[model samples]
Target: MKTYRIRKPKIVVIGGGTGLPVILKGLRSESADITAIVTVADDGGSSGTLRSSVNIAPPGDLRNVLVALSDMPQLYEDLFQYRFREEDEFLANHSVGNLIIAALSEMKGSTYDAIRLLSTFMHVEGNIYPASEEPLTLHALFEDGMTVSGESKIAKTRKKINHVYVTNTNNTDKPKAARKVIKAIEEADMIVLGPGSLYTSILPNLMVQEIGEAVSKTEAEVVYICNIMTQKGETEHFSDANHIQVLHQHLKTKFIDTVLVNTEKVPENYMDTKTYDEYLVQVIHDFKGLRDEGCRVISADFLELRNGGVFHDGEKVVEELFRLVFGAKY
Candidate 1:
């Protein structure tokens, strides 16, 4: 007698910053074949320094995502995430993992190859692909017609972002997806966008022309994990629908099939502004607007407040995602 074995669901998560790893960590516990497509446009802090000095794709986001998906020991993860003290002249503020990735990129001749090799060393349970093989520069055109060139500097403009795009930092060539990025999207059973920054973290990845095109053409159910709070310089006063609108306008397609929104109220005066100053208020709901934009809304209490900061409860979000995937499969 022949027996049939069920295949694991393929989930491709696209985004960067701190939020992508949160979702990835939760998905690591699930029965899914995960692929994390991380943005390489970051130009801030340790990442910016490395990108400028080594001319490599920013490793901070990729490093975090790698740790999230890896089965490495807690001590090893801690060491990788450790940052040098500010007093240190040469090594100040650089993470150990970023340095390792930079060194590996130099050794392998490319960031793409470095991450693939590191994934094996780290025992990463899933695929981690940089949005582009080379470093990308995020350009944000603000409402005032002025444009900002770097991801870290965009928010400092304090002006409304009209739109965002990416460019290859190497030369005049167009930014393209790292190899197999489009293939991952094409084969995915589900594509998760983000609970990250709207313009800087998420849009940077989608702005890659080939990636944007593949996402628009994919048959997978594209789900966006909506932000729990509005970002001060990015999406202040923006409703949940506004976020989706920005994504759709960037891609030139209503590609998102579903959105998971956090309807639970964040308690007033509960945020620790000193630590999480970028986040403003709770993201306002616009179910009608979401529907108007052709998105199936899944509103729930996906909020997880920690140390006075609000974020998505990844496990709950992943559970909903699996339900959606299996629901369609059956």
Candidate 2:
């Protein structure tokens, strides 16, 4: 029998929030090696509550990432994602996975270590890393020259977001990326950012000094999966180009080589306001501006309407990604 060396393309995805996991789950079905670098600046709900009392980095995003990559059965994954209802008092709105990660963090001495242990035990198909080992506070500078701090708070205030950055909760100390994160980026064949909230979820991870620098300097094909809808607080009327511009401004470079955009029309008055109210409008497109920033745009009807809400078609998105990775003559 002849053994052939099959090199799986190393794909590193950097972002947090619910969107990251959708793409990860789709990618899990493909033949690429994946590494997810998740943001730790989540200051909302179970994550925020835990961060406030325990001083561990919020485990919400990390928990979701671990579950997405896990090859475990649906029942186990559901158990991990189970959340206590509002009437539960002390445990109200807390996810079972968040509690598990918190307990593991306490046992192992750090959130990064806890994630690694959980990843192994869950038989996670890919590596999931927290952007920073320590808890971080997100500070956003609004257009009015006023700065608001905290991820949850920023989302509630409908201010014109000037820019956002992250700071270690330990005063002036700068946060550092784990060694594995840097290595993964350095060795990646393709690096993907977003499909998540631009400022809150995606930028938080890139703001980490070393990780940002590594992404800026990496030789891989950097693809950005632009969000399908405009968010109210952070990006109310942002064009697709505006989103890319903001990312470029934050990273201090036009590192994006390709942009995947959704061209499907969202039916007017379709999204249920009471449930998915955070979404404001469909993102407008500016192909010229995207080209000006030196990006090859690949626009498609990547929409999936379910539960009267807007979402990226994960299977379609994965198809495009596969074409880029395996078929592109780059």
Candidate 3:
């Protein structure tokens, strides 16, 4: 057994879906305390179905994060991830995990309580909190006077996301911070935002009024991990600085102390063969230019994922993050 060492720095991660979980898996080794603030605006597929028909918090993203942090064997994780395959009945497309969470919420009398119960069963290494307690919606306002609601739709539209807000702007049921989550942030030596989708995975948590305000006021050194490639439509031609610019525009405050960018380039051969190759994006990341704007851009070896997809090397990325946090001169 690889004995888990405990660095236990209070680390608060704000995002939703696959990206945050991958980061959690890497950071687990650093012994830093971890908290995940996940977005709950999903309104598509099994998540949307449950939300519309059953009036429960969307469970897909939350389930993914839970599985990511779990110490349970792959069998249980597979069961949690199993989606209906045979196309016949009411449960056809829904995930078993989503139903389990919904059922647990009903039994426990609250979604938050149900999550705690489920996490305990899974032996999740860290805490996960929804941005808000209520069954809420995401509203997207595009520059063309068009409006879209729900996380799924906005994600698919391929349009420039102008701004976002919760549907019930007046609702104030900030999900009580998981005791450990707040403590993680308060004590975290560093907090990282991204390598995730800009609008969907990254900004959704930040859109929450209370969470955003708290992040702005927190003293942890904030780092924005810039994505290596841009998402089509949302961040076409966007550079490292462009990503931070969009974030600052949305938040209306400057909370980011540093931005980490990939200094290495993708292998030309691989880039030429990927699907949608022409649309392959590169960072307009100029360190001097970012330094001029008063944001320090830390360059690292952020490379394309091995075996095909475009993503950062998880171990390498997190290792660099460790160095940056502990003030390694690298």
Q: Each model's TM-score?
A: 0.98, 0.96, 0.87
Q: Residue-pair clashes per candidate, as listed?
A: 0, 0, 3
Ranking of all predicted structures according to TM-score, beginning with the best and ending with the worst: 1, 2, 3
For model 3, residues 1-330, the per-residue Cα lDDT tens digits are 233444445667777756677777877756656777777777778988886766667888899889877889999889999999767489988889999998987788666788889989899988887766666677778888788877778856777778876754235555343334455566667778887878777777777666676677777778888888777656777878778778888888777888888888776656534554423566777676566556777787877565555666667777777777667221
Model 2 ranges with Cα > 4 A deviation: 1-5, 328-330
Question: lDDT of each prediction vs. the true structure?
Answer: 0.93, 0.90, 0.74
Decoy 2 TM-score against native: 0.96
Candidate number of the best lDDT: 1
| lDDT string, candidate 1, 231-276, tens digits | 9789999999999999999998899999999999999999999999
lDDT by residue (tens digit), candidate 2, 249-302: 988899999999999999999999889889988999999999999999999999
Decoy 1 TM-score against native: 0.98
Clashing residue pairs found in predicted model 2: none
